[model samples]
Target chain A: MAGYKRIRVPRNTWNMWLWGWFLVAPTMLGLLILNIIPIFQTLYLSLFKSGAFGRGNQYVGIGNYERLIADAQVWHAVANTLLYTVLVVPLSVALAMIIAVLLNGKVKGTSIFRTIYFIPMIAAPAAVTMVWRWLYNPQFGLINYVLTQLGLDPVRWTTDPQVGLISISLIGIWSIFGYNMVLLLASLQEIPRDFYEASDIDGASKMQQFFIVTVPLVTPTLFFVFVTTIIQSMQVFDVIYMMIDVTNPAYERTVSLVYLFYNNSFRYMDKGYGSAIVVLLLVLIMIITYFQLKAEKKWVNYM
Target chain B: MGIASKAAKAAAYLFLITGAALMIIPLLWMLLTSFKTVAESTSMNPFVFFPSVWRVDNYTRVLNQNHFSAYYVNTFLMMFFRILCSLLFSAMAAYAFARLQFPGRNFLFGIVLFQMMVPTQIFIIPQYLMVDALGMRNSIFALVFPGFVSAFGTFLLRQFFLGLPRELEEASKLDGCNIGQTFLLVMLPLTRSGLVALGIFTALFAYKDMMWPLIINTSAQSATLASALAKIQSAISVNYPELMAASVLAFWPMLLVYIVFQKQFVEGIASSGGKL
Candidate 1:
């Protein structure tokens, strides 16, 4: 009986193993070919001077990186990308936090407000950019018209290099704050009402309770929103691509890493250099995320 | 409650109402501008709030002059196939990872997480080359290639499957059901909400995806709505009314569906921690 049981256990284990491998085979293969292999392939491609139509290639180890280091346009894109992230992250997070707290309170028509705010998140970014472009039109835009109505100078919304990145950041903040609000609302709901009641009984005002009880508990989600928004803003592409063009004066001021990569890879057919540029973005994101994770223990409260 | 709290509540309402208006004005403007004439749309001095004629012909003109219908069809097809593939493959892999104890399981899941961490552009150039090698560019297959496997879906569904109880599978095994039968007949039916969330996310991502469609299918005949709207923007220099009309057409389907399935959309996004 013991011998028979041992044989049955091994056979069953074998069958389960076969089924497990069979089930996972398709996704594993797809990721290997479509995503994983391509990462290494891109890294390999970055080492060469790619020919037309992906024909003959001359390998130039570190040459693309060398050029990228001295390339002013690449540095400009790096700065612009970082600046866009800086401009978008704090303001959007603060707005989202305030709105989340407001909606989390005893408020009427919370769902209505949520639906309206999230509409921008659902709309296509390309379409959103087109609408904003029309709004930013210098000659007859509603924004400029309103500015003139208020007896203020009509700022060049998209053309002026000085004001261009800020204009794009406004759209960025508008589109994303709702998403951050939703995440914050979710986390806020997780906090126990006992904490609020306790604070209230301690003679804390509404504003005091918010800072003492609400903000500390919501720090985890706040950290998440901050990190994800920074990573996403670093990859700003469609809005900048749609709003500013090569001929626009703000192109240098608004060009992001992904946009520059798109131009290099597709427009100029410099796949190798594009690969190198994207690699730089990947490394930068990893470094930033690593630091965020390390700093989490200092500020993020899991309880 | 008290006087101070009443005043605070009223203040909160005021703040929320103003914020909601600011969020909605751009979309409302898009709808209003779609019906205006060129002169009215571009009118500077007076600022047209509403169209003089409320022309419906802009929609018809955009449809007649461009490949708007083709874009609709392509976008729908892409969304359908992407959702289908993601659900099927992701469910299987997620079940394996969540339930079955297999050798190298941790190592394999690490690969999925690594893929999720990296930016998607790292895969694009080589994906383009692979599609070109297969002569599949400018086709629906090219549009749906990268979505055939989803790291995000796998991770999401694994969490759901892990939440499920193990008793169901144990009972199915005692009833003479094999692993496949237990999964399909017993376990799969229990995770309806998970599947729905994944489906919603896949569809939303597929709809808003511009870069892949733009790069893979360059021609208007095969373009998605997002990319086609981009083409219209670039093709016509200053046709504000027509451009607004195209924007309206491109986004209204999503907005309408969102209105109808508002709860699902909100819960799907909220629960999954999904971003647009």
Candidate 2:
């Protein structure tokens, strides 16, 4: 909007300016109310001891942060979230790349395969959570029944404290795979045919072309997938909340940062602590995203 | 060479078939288990894949028993308004940022970008407080409150608008059309694909959203399918068949959307990944 001189080519520019303001007002207002203002509010709420039913607020600046630092459950949730991210992020991207590369070939039923892969993405998360919870049932579950057929012991998918987080990560991997594959496939398609043809003319092996040409070309999308997946993994809530009940011994193992925020704010009526937890997540995401962006300069091949 | 090519094709088919099976089995498993009787569902000794008797009645029973039909209506209504309002606002705002030369345009757009970079979960507690203070809890407005405009949508659409030719806007100006008229009458039509993509994503996100609805709409009457299922999950602890049936019901609207707009849906994802 800054300029050296006012150069107008058309009349009624003032009216046009008003029109522009009118058109942009809704989203601007929405952003202010929904995003900008809430951020500062959450920061403010974090500084207080939330009163009865989250009514009164007695500010004890940085006290909530001090408590959160000592809170084992918060750290445990963070560790669990990071573990889930570590498990899902690389695995999802790698799986998506392999599947995308396979489907990139002029294979029979490619569209059908793509459609099938994306069906999980089509269903709501709640539905996915429900179905997986059904499958993870201890006694009557399909997975356990399958294990018995093979004469292997039925492992507790959601019940065991050791395996509960892994179980959540399994669904996380499954849900993310389709979207990542589609993106990687899109990135794969963007790789010019000339690169492959030149590699073929050079007598480069398929693996060599994949390593040298395909990977570099798809790095931008891969990086995008990586950042988004990890960020989302940090916010993992619904599946954990739905599948891991309060009675489950694995509740401690499977709780995510957002889930913990939900428990504190809504369940325990501890808004200040919940705000601190979410603020912590917000800071963690910002730092990771910062590093990702910094790394992109060296790694991501935009072209 | 011919033999190697043939082997390559076969290997590709094998890999894709296996991948598709992994992708589809859970959903197929859901549909199958939904038709089973509760006794059969819980009977691990036999390990039945299909129901001994076709229980299509399970769908009808779950739909009626848990106030699920009402929740479905509530979800669709909220989704419709959210999608409509969000699309309209995002498009207008995106066009403003992309095309108009307004004071503080870059600053405003920077704010939008900041919103995109921040995790949205941070806003939920305050958003909840706002809705509560307004006494709008347990209403559809609560569900739609925080989603009036999508930062992601505006950002994506702004990118789309930036790619449009300047000649179109110039020609509209030459014909005595103002910026607003030109945008609505001329520029808006050009971003159909972008709009459609935003619409699809918004609809999907709205449908998949669980926590907000669970928090705001405590009553099943105003709850969405996602929240309702979360409710039913805790309420009806057992009855695996009924739970499976409810999960299957949750996909019906999405199923309809997929059946109708399958190509656009796929293209939308493809282009979203490709364009950005």
Candidate 3:
């Protein structure tokens, strides 16, 4: 019988609607002006060529796209981006799963443990990046200090091109593992208590039960984390922005697509070329996302 | 059952404690370095816990030298306005999508969902240009405006609103309450957790935002705390202690907030992930 009554509006119905519209007005206006319009403008700007300071923009049909293909820097940025994503994503997700499983059991001071893991999640990225920058410093950094303590030679974390991407990935993993652990922990906990109980009754080993019950049930969340992490990892900016000074030797090896975009657009004020880089990034993201969506069915479990 | 279970639980606790220690190291280092003198901070020997000379001047110097107070004020203002706007806008749009039978409601809701997948980076350039066109560059509006329409918030609130029972709303309507009254009096109270989740998420993003504020606001007076912390890296070299001090001050409130709302954040993260 619930909700059977005729919906009679009050005398202030118009006012309610008005207020509702008003409440969303600024946000809607902002999305329109900032989000929608600028996308088109970026598209339009990409079709034209412009000089420094954005002067003398001339129309060129797909010429920017051709130039972008020939540009080794663009390709290097793409390769560097993929390398960063490849290095960071699997390590982060796997580490998160292990941590979440380890943390999922009944334990004394569970909340305290959760708080410790989540501290990094809540720590300001700039702060964490600064700390990581110090740790990655070639001299007197904690990381090198620890390495020397372990009787190993100190390696240049940011200065060496070969290790630079891996160094940044380590920071990325450090920042993201906590977040991914929290997410996977929720899914892990959702798994029925009876499943574990039944497995225990049947006398399966802990690792056996995890493989047979835990991993399969948590696959959906794992897949979700995987997709999101891939998408997010491709746009690496913060660690690079803070950790790698542009004047450093490993700058080219460490520059991501977004960093390159930032350099072209804001750093150098070459909006046209920057817009072209952005468009390529967008296309890259779209292709990745399209494949991810299509491939999600293969691994993602609904139940 | 009892003996083996207890043994397993002990092993689990040991693992969790190890993980906990690993995670807290960087943050603890930041806090420890904040109180260390310039000499001790970058010295060959790593100092744990108390410093040889407790130099509180690190904090004092950062607050005085770097415009920390203004950053705090700006960040606080940005978060307050951003949270208020997100709650209001997302709630209204969510209600319309969840309760009202409007044309294109489903389609519009779909658009909101689509927005969640499109990375905010894709929109940054356009958004920046838009802010420039609006002549609102270097203002608080630039900081708070783009974040107001949170598709994630709207989608989350919509799901929450949909999950709400209609009986209360019907009773309110029967008692001469209009749709607005029914929603306001009956529905709003029930959505407190949803609102809290959304509010907390918005506040966290607003607090931690570095990229947008760094892009738009060049002046330290109008800049956010995170951006100001980033400035410390570029501002000086070999001032690790002072930079760490600035970072500690910048992160303290967020850290405190996270600790206080730790349970809610876990619950929120869990539910929101499932919802996504």
Query: Which candidate achieves the best lDDT against the true structure?
Result: 1
Interface RMSD of 1: 2.2
lDDT of 2 by residue, A166-200 (tens): 98988998998999998888888878899999999
lDDT per residue for candidate 3 within A1-303, as digits (tens), equals 345345465435655656455544554565666566667788898888776545688889788889999999899899999999999999999988887887787555656766677777777678888887777778877888889989999999888989999989988888888878888988988988999999999999988999998988988888879888898898888778887778989998999998888888888777788889988888888899889888878876787
Which is superior by DockQ, 1 or 2?
Answer: 2
**CA RMSD of all predictions:** 2.2, 2.8, 4.2
DockQ of each: 0.62, 0.73, 0.48
The whole-model C-alpha lDDT of candidate 3 against the native structure comes to 0.80
Between candidates 1 and 3, which one is better according to DockQ?
1
Best by DockQ: 2
**Which residue pairs come into collision in candidate 2?**
none
Clashing pairs in 3: none
Off by over 4 Å in 2: A1-19, B2-5, B274-276
Q: How would the docking of model 3 be graded?
A: acceptable
TM-score on 0 to 1 scale for chain A of candidate 1: 0.94
Task: Please report how far candidate 2 places residue A268 from its true position, in Å.
Answer: 0.9
Instruction: Write out the backbone clash pairs for model 1.
Output: none
Q: What is the interface RMSD of candidate 3, in Å?
A: 2.9
